[model samples]
Target: MSQFTTPPPLIEDDIVQLSYPAEHILQIKMNRPKAFNAMNNALNAALEDVLNWFESEPTLWVAVLGSTNAKAWCAGMDLKQVNLGAKTMWTRNGFGGMTQRFTRKPLIGAIRGYVLGGGSEMVMNLDISVAGEGATFGFPEVKRGVVILAGGLERLVKLVGHQRACELALTGRNISPQEAKSLGMINYVVPDDQVDAKALEIAKTIASNSPDSVMATLYGIRITDEAGSARSAHRLFVDSAPIKQVHSGENTIIGVRAFAEKKQPKWVASKL
Candidate 1:
């Protein structure tokens, strides 16, 4: 990764780094260390493309999102770009292209250092998250005369409840990773060096299961929330396509037989 004092081009080779570290896991690293991995217009566009590709890839079942810079996971949108009157800061998928989209596959955020503004919003959208001990999360947009628009406000309220979310959002104060975990914002708080490993462990565990089942499970959970009522949620869960996919798939049969034989199951379903 190259260091650029100025904004880089929005080409595939410049802003983001994509890798497959395990059988079915995609590792996406924000490579703009010089900018604290901030979401400039170009980086935003690049991330949108990468996430779209991740969604379409048949072999990839999970993703671990992280940044190459140790100083900050992301400092949010590039204020420099904003000051320059840039309008391309957002994409079809929203900030960093991942915050607003509904992904069928799961994304696990591996965070460290500063997670502020848009960075915090990205973490809020992750299905699971592992943060380094040094990680600090906040929504400082209020201090900058902005609001948490990229799904953070609502998700924070859901994760930490109304009072806690208001305290964080209105005050523009930062919280340690442990505090975040206590507030139900992240799953684990490990050492900085262990953040990636812990995230990978969780991602691989999900990848080892039936891809269709995993996708369906995620879809079921999200749909229930979207349904917003007991009856509606129950009906959505019962009528879910992923649930039907699991019942009709061979993975269920294989799992039952494997359990009876005291052996690990071989999942044969295609990626969803």
Candidate 2:
């Protein structure tokens, strides 16, 4: 029983667009080019819907979150919308519907420009991120008399440490993609033209592996963020439901059999 009884509409108006670049790989593009892909209430709801569907559709093993327009991935919250009384910038999942989520599958970021405020916050929680050279990220909430409340504060501090997170969030200064990569906030920084390709390449690689194993691996790694201690995380990782499913599932045996036969394994969609 897949939870997603309805298939995605494939395109979500001018807010979000969905496509499959390869088998088992989904690309979610922010499409609000006129406002630099800024997140308003509609955008938040649309993104949340798409992501919820992606998570439920087990065949979709990995997703790349990016922008359709080159000028900016997201300019953060649409202040004009806010000024006009569109105060709701949140969904059930939080800012942009993805920032505060704990997604079971891998979500990679493909960003190049103007990843600011909530934009930067969304990137903070992605499993892995690839940015283009032109990408600039910052938390400018302080300057606007708001705060980064969408799980960015906790994840950013855990990612880059208290000192660096303080400088980035408190000062409201932008960091280049190169700086972000150096600080381990992002996995790679490549040419602007290759941002999406790089993210897709990684997604394909992940999708080629056993889906159950991949999901279990992601669960094992992400549990550390909430498990309190290394030992606790380790204990939870070994005993977790996802790991148990992977270890006992058909894919485990299939993987071993394929290895023994020296053949590329045909993976099944995970039921995590």
Candidate 3:
């Protein structure tokens, strides 16, 4: 049996709280409610640290990102901090230390209240999202005299049709959770109190599967999603190293034997 080790204690003064609610689930919460959980130098660094830790932990299977504030998930960047010459907003993994990172592990976002500007951009990078009934999504960068440069624009265009994405980007208007769901921006919209529960439910379902298979599936999906064409996607899927790893992993044999014996499988941690 594989021994599970506890993660290290989160650093003091961490604006983002990293906690393990379950053996395989890592929950990261933005903790600056007074500023609406705005992304500042401290918050950005804290988030980067959490993500780096998650990437290194082989036993962890999924991550859930959310905010502690009730009024807003995140109101976006802290202009005051930025104007004061705080440049710690961007990390090697992009905004919020998540947008650019390529990891086989999945991330799910639980959002409520306002998700504007960079908040909305961060959602674009998540594998899945669960929004509260009061959730509002928008790209208001244009209203602030800036462009949506955090990869939201391209993702928005692909998520909804080009026409709708253009309207949202140009007008800087917010959309209700229903509208966002209709546009395929989020996977689920539950009552405000149930947002976290709904996200956890989904995360648990993913975590119960074989880690190697889950990683291979997500890896293939991401590669194909980025390939931009049927021919390219097909080629990428065929050559995916993660898929090959899954086929050669012990978890595959364990899964088959468990299924045949009518028993639950004890999945091994995926090294891919």
Candidate 4:
């Protein structure tokens, strides 16, 4: 069994609270509820630092990201903290330390209420999203005389395609969670109180799998999304070191022997 460990002192920031909801599952609660969980400089930095640690932590396999309250997942960038044309508003990772971050591990979003501008941008980048029935999604940057420059414009198009993205992004119209789900932005929609639970449920399922396989699967998805075609991505996956590592790793042998023995397999901490 995997034992929970203490988070490093750097992740002790109030803006980002880290906890283990289950073995191999990291739960990140954005704690700026007073400001509707807006992504200011401090929150962005805290999230980036914690996520950096999460990615490198051998015992951790998946993460569930949510806010402290259900009234709003996030209200987007804080105008009070960031002025127009200012590059300092962004961390090395784009909006919310997530929109532009190239993450290897899977991240599940627990979302509700108004998620606008950069908030929705972060949604597009999540591996899976579970939202409340009343959750709202929008890119309202255009209404503020700004544009979705924090990787939202391109990602939005990829998520829902050109016409649907333009319709919602151009008019700055908000859509219900159901509509977002139909458009492939959300995976599950439940009551507001159930959002976090559903996300955790998904996270634990992923956590139960061999970490090596999970990382390799995500890597394949990343390659497919970036490559020109299925054929190209398939070829890359066949020749990739990640695939080779999974084939030659100890977990593979453990899995095979466990199946033959008719018993549960104890996954080794992934060295990938």
Q: Model 1 scores what on Cα lDDT?
A: 0.84
**TM-score of structure candidate 3:** 0.94
Q: Write the per-residue lDDT of candidate 3 for residues 1-272, one digit (tens) a residue.
A: 13445464466676777767777899888988988877886777778788777766788899999998877988888877877886645888777876676666899998988898888988888899999999988988888888888677787898898899989889999889899889998889999999989999999999999988888888777887788897888788877787788888899999999999999999878787
Model 4 agreement with the true structure over 1-272: per-residue lDDT tens digits? 26535354474458888788788888898888888887888888888888878888888899999998778998888876666554555788788889887778999999988799889999988889999998889988889998898887887798899999889988998889999999988899999999999999999888878889999999999889779999999999889998999999999998899999998889988878
In TM-score terms, candidate 2 sits at: 0.95
The lDDT of each candidate is: 0.84, 0.87, 0.84, 0.86
Ranking by lDDT: 2, 4, 1, 3
Residues 1-272, model 2: lDDT tens digits = 23344588554465798778788888999999989988888888888888888888877889999999887998898888888985674887888888888878999999988999989889888999999998889899999998888888888898899899899889999889989888888999999999999999999998889989888888888888778999999999998899888878989989999999999988776767
Query: RMSDs, each prediction?
Result: 5.2, 2.3, 1.9, 1.9
CA lDDT for candidate 4: 0.86
Q: List the residue pairs that clash in candidate 4.
A: none
lDDT value, residue 123 of candidate 3: 87
- State which candidate has the highest TM-score: 2
Q: Write the per-residue lDDT of candidate 1 for residues 15-60, one digit (tens) a residue.
A: 7887778887889889889889888888888888878777776667
Instruction: Point out where model 4 deviates above 4 Å.
Output: 1-13, 83-87
lDDT of 2: 0.87
